[model samples]
Each structure stands twice: as structure tokens, then as C-alpha cells.
Target: MCERNHPMKCFLATLLVAICGLFLHPATAAEDPAALLRAADRWRVSDDSLQVETRVQVLGRDGAVEKERLYTVFVQSGHRSLVLMRSPAEAGQRVLMLGDDFWLLMPGSQRPLRITPLQKLLGDASTGDIATLSWAEDYAGTLVGEESCEGQPCWHLQLRATRAGVSYQRIELWLGKARREPLRAELYVQSDKLAKQARFVLDRPEAPTTVAEMVLRDELGTHKETRVRYLSRTPKRVPEAWMNPMFLARNPPLE
Candidate 1:
């Protein structure tokens, strides 16, 4: 063994330790993070075209209900999505996401205002949070190694947005090791500042099928909590006209 006073040996050992910390560990380095992420995506969404009923609620400091809103989200293939405000307070309000662009149409507005994905923030959740279901489509990342999350083992992954405009620029996500279920995520904005932290709740703990709710804690301003619950999901496809921004401006009955 090298003596404690051996400067050369000690310096080499210190450099090795530092290098290891900067790179992926050998044990997890071989695993494909993209494949793992795709597996995790299955637990979040399914089917190319799907209709999801979602409810967003924000809680006050005293745990009292502050605001509640319901939205019907229709997600389709080719990076297309439409979210209709289902609640009475926001009835007739619709948001459309066509590729990297987003449009918002209020109850009586004729012209659909052009908006970016980051500009459409609903409470603590962004429009993309409600519309886009698959992260593998927009994000490319590497496995960041395993860590304990809420008394369970989780695979940690660091993801960065690949598109021009999106909700979060980077995300530190955690998924259940066994089932690859999305457990938690730390969302960052374009500036790389932590915007919010989210925890996923499953419908069934044992043999879970899908994520039932997402509980978000605000880190930017209010520091309050917002709960995004998935009320239901069904297989449905909308007409081609529905994808058109002008058609949405006409406000035809979408049912």
C-alpha cells in the first residue's frame, strides 16, 4: 500500500475519485437511458389518439380550496393537441398546440392569439403539462444514477428539451425502478431555474396501471400546491377540421 505521505499516489487517487464523480458509474453506464425513458413513457400515456379528462385544483396555505378548473385534453399523433376548458368559469376557452406553436382562443374571440408553449401557464401546470403526454418525443437525456425516493428505489434521469419552444427546458425526473413508473420530477424553465417540483400518485400502489394524479409544489412565486388529477381517459379521435386554428375560432360544437 502507498504511504500516507506519498504525494504522487495520493494525487492520483484524488484525481480518479473526481473523474468518477463527473462521469457515469460503470454499473449504470451500460444501461440505455433512452430505452428506460421510453419504458417509463408507457406508464404515462398510451394509444396514439386519446381523450383525457383532467381536473386542476390549487390549494391555499390553510389547505383550503383556492381555485378549481376542469379541462378536456385531446392528444393525437404528429405532435398535435387540443385542450378545451370544461368548467363553467372557462367554458368556450380553448388552447391548441400544433407542433411547436400554441394558440389560445377565448370565449368570444375571433382571432386565435399566437402563444408559445411556455406562455400558456395554467396555475402551476403548463399547457404542455396537460397536452403533451410523452417526454421521449421532446426530450433527450441520460440516466443520472439511482436514488431513494419516498422510501423506494428510483431511477434518476436528467432530461433536456430538444425542441425550440416547450414547457420546461430541463427536467430532473425520477421513476420507479421496477415498473418504470414516473414518481417525481423537478421542472426547470428556459433560464434553468427550478420552476416547480411534481410528485406523481398512482391509482393502485401494487401492480399500478397508470398515474392518477400529479401533485405540484410551486417553487417560483407563491410556493403553494396545485393538484392535477386525471379524471378519465378514453380512446377517441377528433376531425381534421378540429386541428385547424380557424375552425377553433368559429367555436363549433366539439362534442
Candidate 2:
């Protein structure tokens, strides 16, 4: 696995720039794409551990809800996460991601199954969607130009994968000019086909920087959509053993 997490030193400096508007000014901000990506990474939740409830909704061509599921998510500092399905049809199904690796544990499975991040989770959401705030580590970003997103001035960032085994080979991101929050993103395959378009909804009153919901719309067909919402967020300590696939197979039920 590549270096998937930035050091705490960068986190402090980025937080300073994010909170004080020190680097918000276009002129003062670093023009390098990599630096801009680091700045963007600061907008994510960086607590030591985070627990949240996620709800995913799938909409059909006519804008009717086709399916919905709730999930409980646990995230650690080192890009490690566990997602447990809460709905009946998919209950006891869990996905664990450690660094760049992923595993899927289903009910009655003898062992945990390894999976890739590019696999579709639900609707327009991919397995990579669970960890949406990893661009700083996975991609090399370049500032393409200035654009308007959601009627607000924003920076258009073009990102290419730095290492292998990433969900999308390339991505285009838009962030608010003043706040540096992600406004929109376009995911693309290696063939340059637009796979999905995502909009970040940062409306969490408790955690202003954390994106509360992500709206993903399919680029093909009738433009089906999926919305993943973060219902609650709390900081806690997660044990390392819990992230192990062997431990996952042993522990069937999620508390």
C-alpha cells in the first residue's frame, strides 16, 4: 500500500489555512496542484476515529426511489473503515477497507472475500465512495482553471491517479473559492468516459467541514442517482483487531 495518509503536521497547517482564510485568497494560496489538493484534504473530518450512520437512496429514471438502505460506518485515522449494513435484506453484510485494501463479509461466508474499490456498492455509488475524502493521497491534482459551480466561484481541479488500484483513473473536482469545500466532482474511466457525477452537500450543522451528503448521478442511461447521507458523527477509539478480515469473519453480528 502506498502512503495513504498525510502526516499530522500537514493536518495542523492545513487546518490553520482552512479556518483562518489564510490560504483562501486566490493570490496567497499555493498555485501548485499538489498543494491545492492538500488544502482540499483539510476540509475532511480528520479526527482520530469517527462513527456515523449512513443512508443510501437509489432513484430511478422517473425520479422515484427504487431502494434505500441504512448503514453504520466506523472510520479510523489511517484510512481504515468498516461499513455494516443495517437493513434487513442486507443486514450482517459488512465491508472493511484498510488503507488501499478491501474485504467483503457476508452472512454465512466461510471467509472474508477480497474486493476492489471500483465495485458498485449501490446505484451510482461505488465501493470507493465510502471514503470520499482520499484525493490528496490517491491522486495528483492540477488546477485547470477557475469556474462557477452552484452559482459560486470555484476552482476546477483535474486529478490523475498516482498509484494503481484506484476507483477511477481520473477525476475533475470543483471546490468553493473562499471555503475550499468540494462542490462537484466528475469521475472518469481510463478511456475518458464519464462514469459518474457527484455533488457534495456540506450542510451538517455539527461539523461544518464534513460533507453531510453526497449526491451521485450516473452519467449513462437515464441518469439514475444515489444519495449517501451522514446522519451522525462521533469520535471514538477503534481497536485495530476489529479491522482484520479474520476478525470480521469471526464476529458475524455488528453491534
Candidate 3:
């Protein structure tokens, strides 16, 4: 920095430097990607273990409601989750996820069918979408940048799957600038093909504490829309046995 002898010139230079400093963020204050993800995860999960009642509505290309289903998702610790089909048409069907492995059990069958994370549960939503809610646990990446999103400043992050169990191989997540609440995401499969575009709706738009719903649009041929609404969330931990595929199959339903 060069200094000028003139008092007026010196004052102007100092003022200009101060103005630039306001826009400049220090390296030490850089946001941690993991922490940002964890903060954003809270609006969705709300707890480490929770029982979330979910309603999934699949709409056709014309915006006509085609199929609606309900689910009871028991999110547990250690990357274990059990999702039960609550709709009468899909009753007694259960999907269990334990880390990278997944199994599906039919109402009448005692065997648990092995499944993949990318398998669609309904419309554009995959099984992992309902079961795995924490992006910090599944993906890792750096902060991409900041931009205007949904009429508000947003931080954009590009994340990649840390393990093979997650549904999307890569994700472009946008979060609110202030609270770090997730705004939207672009999900990509292992082949790097864009699978779906998702937008989150908050319960309270102005001051949101929880996510009310997620709207997913298919990028595939169907181009249908799927709305996953969180009907209710209760902080409850299921028994350790619920994580077992054989136990889930034999039990059929949990009381």
C-alpha cells in the first residue's frame, strides 16, 4: 500500500479501502462445508432419530394427481432406516436400509428382497430420498459459490457421494444465505445424468424452523412431479432390532 502526503487524498484512499474490506471475506472465516450441510440437515431431520410421517403425491405431466401414498419412516442412528408403506394399496410393504445395503419385504413374503438405493420408491423420489435425510453423512464436497436463488441470496454447494449407498452420486445443493436452510437441489445418478430437480418448502416462509415439503420434478422421460410432504415428525428411536431385514420381514408390521 502506497501512502500520499496530501491529507484529502489520504482520507479518500482510507475510505475506499474500508469500503472494499466490507465486501472482502477473510480466509479464516471461510464456511466449513460439513458444518453448512449439518446445519441445513436439521431443517429436514430435526433430530438424530425420528419418526416422520410422509405423504408422497405423484402427479402426471398434465398436473393431474395420479397416485398418492403414505409412508412411516423410522430414521435411526448409524445410517439405518426403516420405511413402511402406509397407504392401503401399498400396505405391509417395508424397505429397510442398513448402510449401503437395502432390502424390501412384501406383505405375504417372508423373504427380504435385496434392493438398490437408486430404485424408485414412487415417481421421481428414490428409496434413499425417504430414508437418508442427512446430506452431511452421505456426501462431501466444497462450497461452490453464492448467487441469487428464489429471489434471495443463496450459497451453492456441489457435493459427491461419500459412499455407494446414497441415491445420488452427485448433488448441487442451494442453501439460504442466512440460516443455511436448504432451498433446492439437483440430484445426479452414478452415470452423472441429471435425475431430478427438488425444491423445498418451509413451514414458515419468513422464519422457518422446519421443512414442510419437498417438490421433485423428474428429468427423465416421464417428466412427472412428486411432492413429498412431511406430515408429522416425532423424535423417537425405534428398537435396535428394527434395523434387521429378517426381523422386519418376519414382523411385517410394527406396533
Candidate 4:
């Protein structure tokens, strides 16, 4: 018979505690929020610039396709992004985001128009949702609890916007335990009103934590949905000048 304090029993107990520790707060309770946000952000970009193309589809309440758009996106460091519409009707339209400033340049317009990040681009997806930005820099996070998402263990976190002019006032994020990837998120407006929910889609279970696709749904009446699929991700050099709002008017050529 095995004794309670036997060496094998002691080893098993210690191993159990270590296994459970991985699911609990990895960092200290006070620092878990910020640490998790940073960890998630590391897997998001992990580079100076990310050049990718996206195919965006908007669907109505009844699940019929409403509209489709394509874009070439240049996501740079310092929370800056430039989006150039590739569709025929909106080919020349470009959107630039620099820090808290957002601007849109239409085909025939001489000057760029000021826009908000929260403005809906298609279905339930906002302009901010499309741009790749650092959540750790924009929001303050607090660990809420542990929850299961899509049959996987996730760390539920509540993030509040620390800066003005952010898209959502608050966001509830569910991050994967092992990979530190965001699995789901709930965006909220003022006073805890749920504006939308987003799910991160991956190609395979073993794929990189970077999002391959995103599904956004309106939490309100219509329950419209939007799908953004990542077409490609490649290393490309982006000039610093392209991030400025004035660059929209320049319409610089992309080589």
C-alpha cells in the first residue's frame, strides 16, 4: 500500500499543483492583466510593419451577402495604419490612422476628411477593428475570470480605453491560455451597452496565434455579421511618410 507521505505521492502532488498553476494567473494577480495584454500583443504584429490584403464581406440579418470589399493594408509601428481600397468603385479611397487621428480620402476629394475609429466600415466591424493596433498601448486591462471559449481554456479580461477617441469604451477579451492568442472579444459602448462581439478565426489548431480571419456580429436588433479574411501576410517596407494624413492627398505609388 502507498503511504500518504511517500516520495511518489509527494511528487504527484507537486506536479498537480504545477499543472493547475498554468491555468491560474500566470503572473501575479495584480499584473496579470497588463502582462497578458502584452503577451497577446507580441503575437499580433511582432514586427515593424505588416503588409497584408484583406477580403471583407458583409452579411444581412437573414444571412444573405450584402456587400464585399478588398483592401491592401499597411500596418506600421506606433499604432499607425493606411488602408487602400482595391474595389473598383472605391479603388482610390484611402483611410489613414495615426495614433488617435483618423482620416479618409475619397477619390475626387482634394482634402482628407476627418473620421472616427468607431465608425462602422461594414456590417458590425468598425474602422478600428480592421486596423492592427497595439491593445496594450490603448487600454488598461483587468483579469475578470477564466472561461471556456470554443472548447478551450481562456483568460477572460476586461479592458477599458485609457485614451480618448478610441473605438470602444470597453472590451471583454478572451485569450487562449497556452498561446496567448485572442479567441473572442466583446466590444461595449458607454454604460455597459454591448455594441458588438468578435471572434478570432484560425486556419488550424496548430497555426500561429495571428488571426487568419475575424467574424464580427452586432449585439443589437439586426444581428448583422461581417467577415474579414486575411488574404496574405508578408514582410514589406513601408515609408514613414505614408502614415501621415497628408500622404493621402499625395497618393504615393506603391512599389
Alpha-carbon runs more than 4 Å astray in model 1 = 1-30
Lowest summed lDDT across 10 adjacent residues in model 3 is found at: 21-30
Q: For residue 169, what is the lDDT in candidate 2? A: 89
Rank list by TM-score:
3, 1, 4, 2
Superior candidate under TM-score, 2 versus 3: 3
Weakest 10 consecutive residues, lDDT, candidate 1? Answer: 22-31
Once fitted onto the true fold, the runs of candidate 4 whose alpha carbons sit more than 4 angstroms away are: 1-31, 61-64, 207-209, 252-255
Q: Give the winner by lDDT.
A: 3
For candidate 1, write residues 1-255 as lDDT tens digits: 567889899889889987886585752755678887888887768778999999999899999989999999999998999999888887788899999989988767789998877663557877878888888888997888888997889889999998965789999999887788899999999899999999999989877899999999989899999899999889889998999999889875366
lDDT of each: 0.86, 0.79, 0.89, 0.80
> RMSD, each candidate, Å?
5.8, 11.4, 3.6, 5.9
Residue 220 alpha-carbon offset, candidate 1, angstroms: 0.7
Show how many residue pairs clash in every candidate, following the order shown.
0, 0, 0, 0
Q: Residues 82-140, candidate 2, lDDT per residue (tens digit)?
A: 88889998888988888778888998885988898877778777777874456887898
Report the Cα lDDT for residue 255, model 4: 41
lDDT of 3 by residue, 60-138 (tens): 8788889999999999988999999988888889999999999999987989999998788888878999999999998
When sorted by lDDT, best at the front, the candidate numbers are 3, 1, 4, 2
Provide TM-scores for the models. Answer: 0.87, 0.81, 0.89, 0.82
